[model samples]
Target: MFTSRTFKINKICEYLLNAKVKRCYPKHILSNRSVHDVIDVDINGVKLIFPNVWLRDNCQCEQCFHVTAKSRIIDYNNFNVDTKPVKVTKNSNSLQVTWDDGHKSKYGFNWLKLRSFSPKYQKKYNDDIYRSPKIVWHGKDFYEICKKHDYKDIVSSDEALHKWLNDTSVYGVSVIEKTPNSETAIDEIVKTVGFTKRTHYGEKFVVQNVTNTSNVAYLSSSLQIHTDLPYYEYCPGVNMLHFLVQTKGEGGENILSDGHYTAKYIKDNFPEDFKLLTNVQVEWSDVGEEAGNKFYKLYRAPIIEIDSNDEINRINFSIPQRGSHFPGSIEDVVPWYKALKLFFNLNKKFAAKFKTPEGNILVFDNIRLLHGRNKYEDSENNVRKLIGAYIDWDEIYSRLRCVKVKLNLID
Candidate 1:
């Protein structure tokens, strides 16, 4: 036997110890359907406890794992990533498992944990904030929902504006209403939020062309749909476009598109093109600023940024302002050009647009949502001008995500 009363941890030689697989409360089980987990076990010589949703991950089912079933097999990507340990209680019969997708299931902890002898999870769990980054769940409908919320309010409070800001990061867009149609108030509204930070963003002219107050009204015309600060090495992390004057033209609409979505749309539809963008890091530059010093930069980032939950986080795209391309060190330039062409076409495909009135503000998660204008011509001398600013994505995301359905949903 391993021990007389209980198994001695060490010191005895394995040959003399005569140890056996008395019981295993491992973490995961591999099966054709998918991997499952265990929380408790009643076997001897072993103990295990499933971590709270912290250890589980989104199911790589057909819905999420759009790849082949063979490729879909649980790989290193499927395990929990934190570094804390979860204990399995010996003599415990049943175990509970909460998945990353907010799913709950129970399995005989022995069944799943035993099958999961592999490095199932690496999450570090403790009742402290110091544990790896706090896992914040941002949903897919965040953008679409926030767009709807923008139209319902007349004047959102300071607290309300911040909540909307956070929603912008989580959903990639947010809206504030009830902004007075005055230049001073609009400027003050954005300034109240303070400038969000980044090594490369917001230090230069954060509010794009704000000093040129003369053309503010004429510029609000349906502006071309394009990303902000694509030329900079570090693009504006977040952008705030506050509209003080909304009623000059009938349909002075603001359009937006999630570059992440467009990139995916092209990737799944046009594989060859998608490969070009992802394979090579495109370079962008900005110059010829008649007013200030020309802004120029070249940075490297994937066009489509998807997070751990398979959700698009940011879209690094600015085709019109694009400069030379840097296909991978080994990659050829042909694919790079091909992907750029495809991205431009797809970006033009399913962009979103919204109309704003006075007292309305549109906060864009510049990393993900690209903004543009339709076409506005001051038939008369009347013009459309908006006061805007740029803030970091982190600030915006924190405020809105906590607003779980309790805040008024503008529907």
Candidate 2:
């Protein structure tokens, strides 16, 4: 019984009364060129601005999106960058749009807010999606908080397994107590979290004094602190070393130092050295025969690797495996050596020296922690034996996510 003008006025009044109106602009009425480029909608005191092109490209219709894959199916070849909405309507919980091409799209208020380009929303999304942050630790302090999970509990209880994985993710090291003294023990423990990563040494390798050893770990001599497999482009992640036979002699203790912690120390005290290590690439190579197969592996990477966020992502330093091929300018030799020496010295200074008990599994992030062993005598009666295996971070993180979901730790 009312005119079109009266109805439009009444609708605006109702919207103003019910909603906390900020800025709701329809594309058709926007004469300002800049305003026409985006669609702004305010819901629940939050304003989300969506570019016209983004909105069209991200259409959630069945034809434009794949529901199961949760991905866009829109063909970019035919996509119009200048596409504009002919009409926009705000409902109770969503914003509805009719495109110029007669394509209809609807976006939930929450979804739009989450995909906002604002820094706050971007940070929130990253925090919610990324893995848990690493907690860097020093020697004595880390040793005090280092968790030891019983092997049986980890195998049987989901809660226990989650706790153990979380501890390893945060602290980069953990111990599994009461692990059976057998080669299969390492297999059992790794299966709980993920599958064993096969390398040139196979799925598992023995660590004991041998007649002709291809690796330094097989020798009874003192091993300087180093991460394993620096020569590989994609190195192994988690390492599980099970003590089957404990050395009865002195100087057989294991040494562990947090590489991330050491890197941070250098960054704070010697920023130039830290920059050099992070920027200069060095060749890490290995040429040997293992398990009856001869191979030569080489990789070049900075001693310290940082991610896009400039956060420490990896530390690759292996003196024995380092190739003599210096690809850098001749002037960088002494400075590079000085930085390398500082890193090695700090690793030794901050290392935790301890003898892992027999039947205990020493699990650690191979990429984050440098591990070594002291000199030991390997006689008939006091022979030291250990079984070592590697698992990738992909499997570990996937397992952690599954456990977290099962435990309702995350959605």
Candidate 3:
């Protein structure tokens, strides 16, 4: 049934179809090419371009890379920046390279794709791996979504711990109910996340009216909503306040406002004021002696800090600790004051008033939330006592990532 001429025609047709299939790859996927300083790799239709120096430094050989340590053991001092790839071969799941120095290196397709020097990949990495997304909220609406976790569950279960940290990351606040009233109870809660951050007030501080008060918070007065430690260059990230004893008298209710929500409102309604708050640098200082140690801390920064991405990062506002000296020009004084007044008024309007029950731990992101309390009478019969501590964001987020990994929420 077959002839020589028919067989030759069939072979020609098959060869043509195979060639056409090879050319069918999408144009967006770059072909393998080496430039003067970089190599363009095409992995299953995804384009990944890598620099020559970077690829050489990231060689995956046992001699150049330590498998146990997951670090590069190559000598940087003897590294050749101009190293060239003498040969390159692509497999189904990896790329093989032979360097000019006869060094053989192989890289997994997924690994190279993750480290792609492309804007799209970079943004994907940031969104998926860098940090959790923040949810800006108003007090009135946030109150309904604010769920309290049991103290025992938070300390005992990883699921509860992840939920608390995740909520705090998104909403910037969380509450724990049924906490022990003992002095060391705060320590147990803090140890679950990280170590206690010590300040001039010691590892932890107490908020109660005293005979000789060093801090304004120790006085029996209505405090304005504000962030703590604006004077510190590296302010504490989170604040945990345990209501050990609540006052029987009227007042002493907590006031809370989301600084990010207020900032967004200002940016939308009063753009000029928002710009002033983010651009004008002011001095925040604290002076006096506490716990038999004298210290004066001062830091200069804008009230509203804007990150490189032009997003509100943190709010620094403390009326009691603000410096007397004005740093702006004379003409900028009234406008700055007006802007600050508007900000304070907006904060008050958006504030949530609540009375945290005794034996409850109210935790919040100090950098993102403004907090204060009403004046309460402190007598022998009724005394208001609160134990407070701080934990850095780095520690909290680190624990969160580890918990997520353990729970298989992320790879």
Give the candidate number with the greatest TM-score: 3
Q: Indicate the residue-level lDDT of 5 in model 2.
A: 17
Stretches of candidate 3 exceeding 4 Å from the true structure: 1-46, 62-70, 90-92, 118-121
Error of 2 at 273 (Å): 1.1
Q: Summarize candidate 1's per-residue lDDT along 46-137 as a digit string, tens digits.
A: 43333233234433344344455534343456455542223322225544433444444344444444433323222221111111232222
lDDT of 2 by residue, 265-301 (tens): 9999999999889988899998999878999999999
**Candidate 3 per-residue C-alpha lDDT over 247-326 given as tens digits, one digit per residue, 9 for 90 to 100:** 98899999999999999999999999998899888999999998789999989998899999898889999899899888
- TM-score each candidate: 0.55, 0.84, 0.85
Cα displacement (angstroms), candidate 3, residue 147, comes to 3.5
Clash count for each candidate, listed in order shown: 36, 0, 0
Q: For residue 236, what is the lDDT in candidate 1?
A: 69
The candidate, 1 or 3, that scores higher on TM-score is: 3
Q: Estimate the TM-score for candidate 3.
A: 0.85
Badly placed stretches (over 4 Å) of model 1 are: 1-144, 147-163, 184-194, 197-223, 289-294, 306-312, 325-332, 398-411
